[model samples]
Target: MIRKSFYMLWGTQTVSNIADIVYTLSLVTLVFTQSGSLLTTIFIPLFRMLSKMISGLVAPLIMSRLRLTSILMGSQLGQFVIFTGLIFYLWLSPEVSYPIIFLAVFGMSFLDGWTDPARNALIPRLAEDEGLMKANGLMSVSDQVVKCSGWALSGVIVAVIGAIPTMWIASVSYFLAMFFTAFIRDPYAAAGVQAADKVSSAASGAGDVARKPSYGEQLSEGWKILATNRRIRTLAIVDNIDTLGGAAWLGAFILAFVVEVLHQDASWWGFMNTVFFIGSIAGGVFIVARVKKLQKNAYLWMLFSLLAYVIITFFFAFNNVPMLALILFAVSGLPVQIAGIIRRTLIQQNLTPAETPSAMSALSVLSNFTFAIAMLLLSWIADRYGMRDMYVVAGVMTTAAVVIGFVYRSAFREESSPAYASEENVAVNKA
Candidate 1:
């Protein structure tokens, strides 16, 4: 099952991520060609942010209706159609209409959100125990390879050939992905099984999945779980801290720093981004390898996260030297990757399947909400102080994580949690 699922997942992700990279690079190139405004360039990513929330909401419904394999294949097929339609729209388009193109991109992003979780959930469906983390790591590995290779190559293609062919290449990749997905069976294919399980759980009062939820119920339940569940809330907060501490701010700061501090071109965005990317690649692999080893000191992963952010904050704060700052930022990637996998694996494995999507979504919603709020605050600080000064504020927020981790370290290290223990083994496995 692992072998079959591995091939299926690899094919599914490789093509999908590659297609996305092409589309994005193409879109930016198209916008720059058409409008010649950096704001339009920025809005592309901003609008697509909606897709994350969309994915969080869609994951449960997609999983509920279709099996994991079916969901995976269906998503790939939808991407194919979306890209084809986008091409048609472009062909029909006399001018580059931002709204229509944005819609196409947003629509694709909407599907992307659900695609990831469903694909992720399928890991446990395919393999369990120690292998679960390994499977996720492999998925990340494929994702990184595609993301890196596609973005790098697409740039050259867009420069030489133009955005139109890039979009076509993207569309073709989706179809190929769809073809690969079609070959695999949904490991959790039977909606009937899920339905029956829901019924059984509801009957036994295990946990209800059948009752229709009001939007408020969905919203409130999200908070209730996070607030009351010590482990869940703590991890979510730490994760949120990591994201909110600097991601949205980093791009601007790094860009400014590379030019002003490093005395490099405005073009160093690619190099800086690649540095971060390389860090993530290394970090993701480390997570897969080290998650089990850190089972006892899982809280230490949060420390790693805090340390990374603090380093990032400090790296950017007073530094006029771009190369050193870039190096520090690259070094920061390891902990961020470690913290990400640790948090995701713990959350997904701990929650029941029914709760998985909501919990994941809820956590993400918080991350988004906080980042937006922090962006405004950081912008204000940048206005009042300077870009580098914002790092000081972020540095403080980053260190807060260390304090939070110490507070919740006990919860993270709870081997009694169902995730860390098999039903057959109730005793904590202290190595």
Candidate 2:
């Protein structure tokens, strides 16, 4: 039954992911064709990303009141309704206003933001500790596969059908996503029962009413968890620093590197992006295949990945040869992807099911917020010091993460206490 629930959750997100890509492509095409302004088209993604960041910031408030499955289902249903309305507005209005289109986009994106943390939080509950690594690996592989092909497929889709029809496809997809989300069983019932038992025990005391935590306290829950938990805090710090450094791979910087350093044309830029995704997919496959062996040394695997990132990124900064750069780019994706899966698994193992949603929400906000700032910082570095220097800076930042990971190495190690350990992570103390 748990396995079935996991698959349902998986299917729900997969369908929604395809819809999101298709919808974005269609919306971009619609905006460009209507306004014929590059800046206007650019604002679509800008608005969507910013709204998601805002949503992530506020998701904890809703998570406190709603189950993860409810949040997931509601988010998808909201997206469906908004997209359907947007489609209708576009069809009815002979001239659609950019503001109206962007408003609808923002609404949908705001709702969409809750889905990720909810999905991630739900995974451990459905899969349990024994299956957590495989669950994460499966999700990672599906995500990479969708990302690897979604854009290209959606591009072709938008090209064939008009933007409106393509959007209708997305609307239908969103509805189906919501449908699948509805079937996901609540995995927190056992936790709820445990809480009830505690409440009853407390109520047995005369004239003792347990005070519920205040809203402010609940709002700060995830942040408090990160602040108080050294293991999770260390991981969060490394994750954010990695995110900042990883911004070197932003399209603008990569395009600059391809043109100026590799001396390749725009097509090669596209090829490099494609190869990056392919490498990530391959990395996911590698991890999934070796899950049992790798699970025992998850922390070590993460350290290895960071070391690989430090080396590959530094070499990648200097290489003028396009072929060698391609090889380096492809190889670089492996460790990073592996590290991502392992890191996520470790965090899942370390947190209780109830804490996962809020923690994931907090992490999501930090990551998106960091990426936004990193883009600006990396862009400046690329402009002032040249693109090669930008990547070198990236390497330097990741090197700090490696140093910190080594310093806090014990935090990720296996513990005899199952309270902080999972079956797969039990042997990671060898790190």
Candidate 3:
């Protein structure tokens, strides 16, 4: 079951990333061909935010309906259709308006947001408790590796042919992903006895006899659990801080640097993203071994990583040298690696299976809110105050998170009972 889950997830991740990378490059080319305004670039992130906001509201509902394997395979099939339709519309029909393309792509982005949480929530069902963190780290590492590799590969595809062929590669990747996902035997029995009972018996494809958990009731219960769960609630805040700090480096501030600092061609943008992603992949591997360590002292590592990121942000803002900033960005990339591993594993550990999807949605919404607001606020500060000085604001706010952490330390150390600690994690696997 574990082996099957790993292969299945790898397939989905690789295809999804290929689809993303190709779509991104294609859209940039299309926008340039149509209207070359710098502002048009904002459409990529705008659709992204629309997707996140929508997921905050709807992802749980969508997650609840389909079994994890179906949800994953279905997502790929959806991508294949969406990417194919966009290619035909843009390259095939010149008369179609760009807004039509944007709307179609935006709807696709909204659907794409469903993939992450649903996939993450499915891991615990595949691996045991001790293995959970490793599972998450492996997935995170694979995502970065695939995303970066896809970005590198897309350039060759784009150069050899054009955006249209590149998108075709992406479209095909999604379909191949669907093929791979067909191998995953379902691992999850639904949560709560009442809601899960209605699901087809093992005579059907589902792994075990599952109790049907009420979607509405399970979701509501998750909120109640979250309300009482200080560890999760506190870590969620720390996760937001981590995202906000990284956003300074990834979002507006990075853009500000290219225009104001590097003074290089805008084409380097994707390449720069690839560089940090490579760093993140490197960090991801080291984190797999450390994930269990994090499980032991989850709060401390969480706060420690946040502190590292905060300090890295301060360095990023004032540094005059591009090389120095890039190095710091690599280091800044570490927290994102560790915190993400810790956060997802902890969420899964803490939440009941039924509540997992809604809990993820709730966290996704809050984290996305902080990221968007930070991006906007940082942009405003760079415009009005001074680009370098915003680091001071970032530093101050980030430092405050430590104080919050100090007060919340007890909650973060909540002990896991024996039942959740399964033998699969501790047992030696030959793979």
Per-model CA lDDT versus the true structure = 0.69, 0.83, 0.68
**How does model 3 score by TM-score?**
0.85
Clashes of 1: 0
Return the candidate ranking by lDDT, descending: 2, 1, 3
Q: Residues 1-431, candidate 3, lDDT per residue (tens digit)?
A: 14466667766776777777788877777676667776876687688787767755667666667776777777778778887888887677857476877786787777777777777667776766567777877888888887778767777778788877777877887888788878876555444222334433422456775544556654554355456555567767666765665566664466667667666555545546767787788768877777556667765776777788777877777787766766776676677677677667776766555556667777777777888898888778778887677776777677777667778777644455321222222111101
For candidate 1, write residues 120-152 as lDDT tens digits: 565655555556566666677677667767788
Superposing all C-alpha atoms, what RMSD in Å does each candidate have to the true structure? 4.1, 3.4, 6.2
lDDT of model number 3: 0.68
Best by lDDT: 2
Alpha-carbon lDDT of model 1: 0.69
Better of 2 and 3 by TM-score: 2
TM-score on alpha carbons, each prediction: 0.85, 0.93, 0.85
Task: Give the per-residue lDDT digits (tens) of candidate 2, residues 256-290.
Answer: 89999998998888788888888898888888788
Winning candidate number (TM-score): 2
